[model samples]
Target: MSTLSTLKDRIGRYGVWSVGLRAEDPARRGQLAEAATELEQLGYGAVWLGGSSAARHAVPLLEATRTLTVGTSIQSIWDYDAETSAASFAEVDAAHPGRFLLGLGVSHAKLADQYRRPYSALVAYLDALDAAGVPADRRVLAALGPRTLELARDRAAGAVPYLVTAEHTAQARAILGPDPLLAPELKVILETDPSRARTLAREFLAMYLALPNYTNNFLRLGFTEDDLTNGGSDHLVDAVFAWGDETHIRDRINTFHEAGADHVALQVVTGGDRDTLPREEWRRLASLLG
Candidate 1:
């Protein structure tokens, strides 16, 4: 099997991305590990520590689970430099050979004070990673546009684009070609009421709307300026956050798979703190996806 195919086989196509995985307190870290172990036992392929996680954030999870591959959804280029990232990867790989994936990305300009010439910066980081002995097969780029996507294909194992539609997934797959892992973060709301779901979606999307990269991506996906105005249009919310029952969520994930995504990392959106583990929703989806 090709590198991506092998990694895909190991990681599985369904994974969970949760921002709460970074349990900094040494005391409660075991609880974090226990939660990850539960997911692995439940049969989800991998766990991606979301919210611009550092490489070390994945170590505890990898150390805890025997076979579950743990990765950073997008370790900020600004946060941990290539050398530190490589060092962290080395520590994890030494303990657990192939259970870690390094996810790299240039965060939003509004968020990162150092965000400048993202493409050039990403290339430089990848080059540094190469010099630091981090192989291309063990990393993924958080790409959203054509340039970054092409860079991801050339330099890394795959692209992990966030806040995107399945149509965007199809576009990215065509760009990355037949190889490279195409993993997209698919946010889902379990609410059945249309009004309630959209409200949650719009609220969740508000921050992203203020960010140019995401809004530009939406524009590229055929949404107008008005559609992006005031949170998001109903059409926009429906496309972005797959809401309603279990079948609806499954069908939406299938659309992404059909559109060429190798893995679909589900981010269960809810009113409560996303920093807390959404075990109930995850359990429900685990049953449904199975």
Candidate 2:
């Protein structure tokens, strides 16, 4: 079967990326499962399990939802080697088949004590998956800059870039050559009040701002050092996050689509809290996107 075909058109054009949807969370299993099923009923395309997820983490979600594509916003490469990762991937596929997609990434250097030669490590990892019979089409790389994006185009099914601007989506499409999937993770603040929304956004943005992988991408996308500093300039924050009411959110999603994103995984951020499931926001977004 073709790789994208396996992903299925059910992926539609939009989906949710959430850190709170972790399968490993001991307290939220039943809640998370019901939420995953609820998402499919809502007509949203996919649900990206964000924040250092493992392939094992995708299983319960897949078992909960029949057709919803549950992918890792990033399965941190630093945590799982290719062989072990591929084995876990196979386990999930055995139960759910094409209903799962693996989104692998070389996580931030500062976070991973063993981080080194990321591009080279990723290359070797992809090679291992290839040998393990993992289809390139069923996977995506969390690419940011040019070289990794190039690798994503050549080696994986496509790229799932996190915390990127619409312009970055356009640039990624140019590299991907019209066929590879371009699903950028877009942060959204559902509040209508600009000050409140920026306040909420900056809380989430502060941590990412410290990560060079993201800041460097901002630089590549024309953001200055000044823009990257001090909790991110308004221009930089505005570019990275979609804020202020439903109209603003829709416009931002459409901008990514217009710029070349085939699918956008909306990561909803409210008051910088990641523990609570944003079901209300997910429901609201479903109505707008549909």
- After superposition, which runs of candidate 1 have C-alpha atoms over 4 Å from their true positions? none
Determine which window of 10 residues in candidate 2 has minimal summed lDDT.
Answer: 1-10
lDDT of 2 by residue, 249-270 (tens): 8998899999998889998887
Q: Candidate 1 clash total? A: 0
Local error of candidate 1 at residue 61 (angstroms): 1.1
Model 1 C-alpha RMSD vs. true structure (Å) is 1.0
Error of 1 at 140 (Å): 0.1
lDDT per residue for candidate 1 within 184-274, as digits (tens), equals 9999888889999999998889889999999999999999999999889998888878888889888988999999998999899987877
lDDT per model vs. reference? 0.89, 0.86
